[model samples]
Target: MGIVSTYLRAFNTNKLDPYPVEILKRVDKPTTVVLESEIPRLDERESGFNRAHRGDFGPHLTRERQRFVGKHPLSAALGNMQFTLAHVVDGIVAQEKAPLPNDPALMARHIKETAYFLRADIVAVSELPSYAVYSHSMATGEPVELNHKYAISIIVDQDWKTAEATVGNDWISNSMSFVAYSTSGFIACILADYIRRLGYPARAHHARNYQVVIPPILLKAGIGEMCRIGDIVLNPFLGPRFKAAVVTTDLPLAVDKPIDFGLQDFCSKCGKCARYCPTGSISFGEKVTRNGYEKWPNDMEKCTRGRVGNTKGSGCGVCVAVCSWNKPYTPFHRLVQWSMRNIPVARRFAVWGDDLLGYGQPKLKNKWWLDLEEVDGKLIVPTQAGQRGNHRRKQA
Candidate 1:
């Protein structure tokens, strides 16, 4: 076998029964996905930021994203990390180059191994889809010009312990998102720089910055399946509790395929995220065709408002907190996960059991951060602390 094939064989050949087994159901190609062959490239300018910029959701989101995130110490720390890394996203290519094989498969394997070594939870590669690139930059309002041959997607899980304790949209909400966002962004930046040093054109697309829409590339790259929680992809291991960053490059590399861990069926039966969504944003009804792809229609306006206008916290993650797939990999959770993937009937039980066991409720005693909010211009003790505040559901 080639070096790449050997590496992938070992990677996909885990003895953990039905763990990688569940995830590595490789086929000649991705399951026939419903896609708009000529979908319009998304415009980041017209996104929720547009509404935020228009003073629709709230003023804080428009003036600076930090207004919401800087309310808490932990969230502020994570947000600051992004600020530090935001400047060097694109950098100089080194004149001296490292000797490496020209084989795409070998290169792909090496890149994946590199990302894993850098603490990326999951990584996938795919040919860059035309529709995946954003139509324009929200930063400069110019058409984003990117024609990379491959996309390297990196995913990072938000710390589950924090989510386990949080009431979803608590003081820790933006921190959870930023923690994953910053981590994945860090990985992507280094990976892209590495590729450029090898005499290739590479650009890191991250949380605070991007020239592409990630979910589409992620869907095509086999990292996860499309989720009902809007356009985000869901990894079987991390579910919706992760954020992603991508390195788009012209470096030749082998690619992965879209995954199918029975998320569509599970999401259909268990509309729990929609049921428990605080802003009535996620659709509890059937999926529909929008601009070509069949997906659950999300009210980004309501979702954005819920996140920006949260009285008790900086942002929302109720959907992530309550996803049936968002469980830790304990033996019990593993068995349940296997059953849900293999035994179709178990999906209903899994969904119902998540609530019966009171899995979505917060653990207030686990709260450890300060109860501060940035009001007007200064930080002060908020009247409603995230730990003591009310959520859509009570604790178990």
Candidate 2:
């Protein structure tokens, strides 16, 4: 057998060494519990939370409102609906496992069509490298192994409406996280079921519970290239304002080629995300060797610690919000990104122009959600004393 075939057989037999579980187990469990409990309360107090702890771009809630429509009931309902449909699709795919489908290309196309119909902004397939699956899951400290050889990476767009609403308060920002996670989870679950129905072994990798690193798989799938912000950068679309989920399987499919869009060159000069990172976790230097790869290395520990220490919410995405690449689907910006892809010299100018236009500045006036009177008929405004207390404890 060829080397690739041999490795595949070995992987299927579960002979590969699993990732160490101890690293994951080391996190303080009590702290996690406390964070989980605070998420909802934090969502309610988003404006107060931001007012208390101002960062480089000002109150995070204010910035969010400028970008998104805030926590609208319709958007939240749509997210939940998409999630439910994903589960239904999963069931259908699982039950239809074939006497083996005849054509791999046709099958892949159908899968992509189904995924797009289910609310995925983009879908692509690629061979899953053995290294893509982690040695262990950090959340549960569980030893994990993946025998699957293919992965389907799905990207979902964050609502521009909700992102615009973020500037009003913390509730809007937290709600976006809620929508993305819930929607991505549903997509992964359904895709996993679909692969299994084709008589192939499959598994869904969702947020905080993934076996595979998403960005690499996304790159392999021809969906997008890795940008300076260390996330998969989509083109002529949602840019960096998207979340990813993966479904690994043994299904046969064609792979995609990596695209060159001058992102590396642009990132070398543009430190927008690094500057906007509230925890200073993003890198601002040249790419360096880490685990045998040349890339920007982030301070993952510091990032997580910052999230844990946040008195208002579960996590942060200030880097994402402020990135020049995080553009809405506007004709003017689309033309700019398209031009930058073809003309290498225009990249630096593009980056500079984005900054000059105040692209990264937070907007305070768009705070529509701050006027919210109540939810479920009970008033939810933050008490003045509580707001003051949180502000006093803000980190410099």
Candidate 3:
């Protein structure tokens, strides 16, 4: 057993390397998709949840946002942690700049390595587009003026194990999101502070505090491509199964170009996300031009209602749960992922095979979490239909 343990540890271990997976190392420049655009700067207040908070979506949705945290115990706990961290996202930059290398390439590599050392799953750098910055803050309704030259995007994977165990809009839904949200936010905060210590202006952008829009940054940083799941960017590896945090910095670094993994074609062929979306929010039709980019546009009001005002669960992730791209990285799954990227015919067949193989259904035997909800100030087993959000009845 000792010898086997040693062999396994030595198989492909890199003490200095961050990624244990091989696919990440193969990702490089020269993006395949050509995005034509005239994107305008957006206000942070226009976001779905923010709209819910401001009663723009509806008064009922505003009430939903007020009680959003306490709907699920685990989600509430995680939300509190991230909200606390938001208070420390910005700080004073040091007066003197630290001595550093002249090469942007070297600096880029070093910064990425630092993120990896801090447990970031994946990191990419991009020249921050001015349009990505929000025109005003949602929290304070004040003008946002971020002029950072480079943006460091970091991704944290939401555990696939938990995703496999239950329905998309169950007690575990928001917990899946907050797990990635808090972890990525923690890493961004520390990375930003480290840059400030080096005499660079930096600010962390996470769930609780974001002054910048993420989709454009994700595209420009080679992180992923915009998918049919509205503005959500899907990575070749992580799919729509992860959350991201960003650090906007004046620190010099080499930026990566956008990547194309044939997601646009694949998403077009596979409508599994649309088929399984609880509120029928995802579009099952062709791409259309909205916000200067030609992509599938979803109903934001319905989607927000499905999430923030969900009576069936804490929040909905049916789209993420059923996406063809969301799969475990087993040997067979990896082979399928490669074919989906390279072979056009395979993309069509993979979609059919996913449904045939029952890839989207819940595996109840794997359930590990309690079906508990927090009401007022106590945690209790949700026995009634109303308490459990009447999700089973809704699905019927």
Candidate 4:
């Protein structure tokens, strides 16, 4: 078998059991929300600086603002997908009343095939180590039991056309994330159904219903290495232009080896993503041992708050939009990726050469859908933040 097939086989080696129906009895009860007075409106004055920057920067800024708001829509859409899957899985689990099929290998194959059918770019499965499960549940305000034994990691590709149209803090940049998240959610839902049909206990872990840390699971699945930006950088494919989803189950499965694509060395020297991060959430230095692993720890809270306070959008994707690895499926880029994968020493030079060639620079005029408007009367322009001047100082 080829390397890809070998990896796939390794991922598929697990057993499953009948779904656990009684577990549903332990599910936390839903809560009710009380409506307050009239909803408070966001202050325009508070957002004046962001708006002025947007206006001065032109259509790109407006697009960036729109992209942030659009992220919420995609997130909401993913939530709905999870909801539907959970309902289906709940019925299956209740009927089975025991651990479903315990074949890890079959479950892995089913996950990969179903995820691809649902539009995911790639899917891989790995065993969920005890340490991988959260020690505490933030939602329930209690410690979580490490019951899930496996995780099916899924990756969804971003729209390269829309990404190419980005101009920094524009709507197009944010839209890329939305597309990935929305697609990942759909893929997760489908995989959940497949597992249930195969007589296994499985749960879709999308944007809101995750019980596992997806990046680590993807790492174990050999999909990608964790970069300095604190995101998975898929080999020869998505780089950072993708979102991840996970499906946790009691199914037995084989685990994939962690990939070592010299990303650690590449990220150490290539700070383009960090430089492009508007909120400085990405680390600029070396990876450190944190919580028992080597990683470039990110300031997620700062990044999240920055997006919330921006007034123009709910979140940001400048780091993803500017990564050197986040390229489209062009022959030249593919050749470069192949070279970097085979020859590790050449990666540093390649990174330098790519910057010299302005490969990571966002194009403002490549807006294919700049003139397109939705039925809601909102014009879909590219974001201007993508076009911000390169802030990296030339290496001496």
**Candidate number with greatest lDDT:** 3
Rank by TM-score (best first): 3, 1, 4, 2
lDDT of candidate 4 at residue 42, scale 0 to 100: 27
What local lDDT score does residue 304 receive in model 4, on the 0 to 100 scale? 52
Looking at model 1, residue 135 earns an lDDT score of 91
What digit string (tens of lDDT, one per residue) describes model 2 on residues 286-315? 676544345666775455444434333323
| Candidate 4 per-residue C-alpha lDDT over 1-396 given as tens digits, one digit per residue, 9 for 90 to 100 | 233432343335352211111111111111111121221222222232345334543555545444444344443344455455444322264345345456666645655666666767777777776555654543453665547678888777777765666654553444556567656766776676666655667777665444565665676666677787863444446777778878777667765555555566677778887777777777777776555556777875556555544544334567767787878765566566656655677888888887788765667678653322232545443233323555555245
Listed per model in order, the count of residue pairs whose N, CA or C atoms clash below 3 Å is 0, 22, 0, 42
Candidate 3 wrongly placed segments (more than 4 Å): 1-37, 384-396
The candidate that achieves the highest TM-score relative to the unseen native structure: 3
The residue ranges of model 2 lying beyond 4 angstroms of the native Cα positions read 1-101, 138-140, 164-169, 231-236, 312-314, 368-396
As for lDDT, the candidate ahead, 2 or 4, is 4
lDDT: the better of candidates 1 and 4: 1
The residue-by-residue lDDT of candidate 1 on 1-396, one tens digit each, is: 232342343456443222352245555444435565747889988788566866766666666443766767778889899977787677777676668786888888789888988998888889998888999988788998898889998988898888788888777789899999999999999999988998788899987788899988888888777778877788777789889999999888998877767888888888778877888888877788786577788999888877777788878898888788888867577678767766799999998899899887887787777777776767788777443222344223
lDDT of 3: 0.81
- Ranking of all predicted structures according to lDDT, beginning with the best and ending with the worst: 3, 1, 4, 2
Estimated TM-score per prediction?
A: 0.89, 0.67, 0.90, 0.71
Better of 2 and 3 by lDDT: 3
